[model samples]
Target: MTQELIRATIETLEMVTVSSLFSVLLGLPLGVLLVLSRPQGLRPRPALYRALDAIINVFRSLPFLVLMIMVFPLSRLITGRATGTTATIVPLAVAAIPFVARIMEQSLLEVDGGVLEAGLASGAKISQLVWTVLIPEALPALVNGVTITVINIIGNSAMAGAIGGGGLGDLAVRYGLYRREPVMLYTSVAVIIVLVQLVQWLGGYLERRLRRDGKVTASA
Candidate 1:
């Protein structure tokens, strides 16, 4: 039982890590494009902005469970199976991309307008401004956004188990619910809670450190 729980825990971590990596990779660029293509932006494009915005909204509107089922075929196509941790990552990543994108868009929007103006005045190209000024200035907020996205992903990963995507969630359903072992259920729940708490603490620490460093940089 102990070994079983540990293995399930590791599976959960792996799924979360892989899905988060892909989500950030895809979502971050979409988010940057979203901001840049908005009205009054560095490269405003009303048509493109509206199109992207609508697509994001459509994905975000779907419940995770529905999205997972809807994407099962694609998941199978990608992974050759749709009932394990690796295959589960496909739907998880799909659901998460729009979420991360919105979070990033919100965080980037929070950067001071004056800072962007200064970058422009200094003759910074759009790429340079985004890489240096925008991202750096928004680091603390972006960290917080990542923390939120991670927590959300963790929850969604558990739901993935309902379709045979194994993890602590699978353990809970199989042993705890099916076999009527309350201990197994509670243990899985406790493990998830602990993981979330740890991530939250780590995110807070990083955000604070970035803020302090930013202040020091400004003072210098």
Candidate 2:
């Protein structure tokens, strides 16, 4: 039982890691694009911004389960299977990307307008302003948003298990539900709690470090 639990836990973490990483990798750029191209935002393009915003909203509005099923064909194309750890990553990452992107866009929006104005006044190019001023200024908020996204991903990983994606959640469904094993259910719950706590702690610590660095930079 212990060995099986350990293996399942590791597999769960691996799926979560892959899904979350891909989501971040894709979402960050999309978020940056959203912010930089909004009409009232940094770059301000009407048509392009509206189009992107619509796309983001569409994905965000869909339920995860529906989204997962909707993407099954694409998942099979990419992973060559509609079920398993690798197969689950496709939909998990797909569902997470827009969510993280929206969070990132909001974080970018929270940056002070005055700082952006100052950068503009100083003749910074759009790209330069984004890289040097906007992103750096919003780093703390961005980090927090990323933490939130990661936690969401962790929780959503369980949903992946429903589609035959192997993980702790799959174990729970198989043993706890099908076999009526209370031990498996309780064990999976405990592992999820530990994972969430660890993520929260790391996020808080990093947020503080970024804040401290921002303060030191402002002082200097």
Top candidate when judged by lDDT against the true structure: 1
Instruction: For residues 1-220, write the lDDT of model 1, one tens digit per residue.
Output: 9999999999999999999989989988898888899997889999999999999999999999999999999999999997799999999999999999999999999899899999999999999999989888888888898999899999998989877888988888887778999999999989999999999999998888788864544321
Model 2, TM vs. native: 0.93
Which pairs of residues clash in candidate 2, taking residues 3 or more apart in a chain or in different chains? Answer: none
Question: What are the per-residue Cα lDDT tens digits for candidate 2 across 105-129?
Answer: 9999989899899999999999989
Tell me how many residue pairs clash in candidate 1: 0
> Against the hidden reference, what TM-scores do the models get?
0.96, 0.93
Clashes of 2: 0
Model 2 Cα shift for residue 75 (angstroms): 1.1
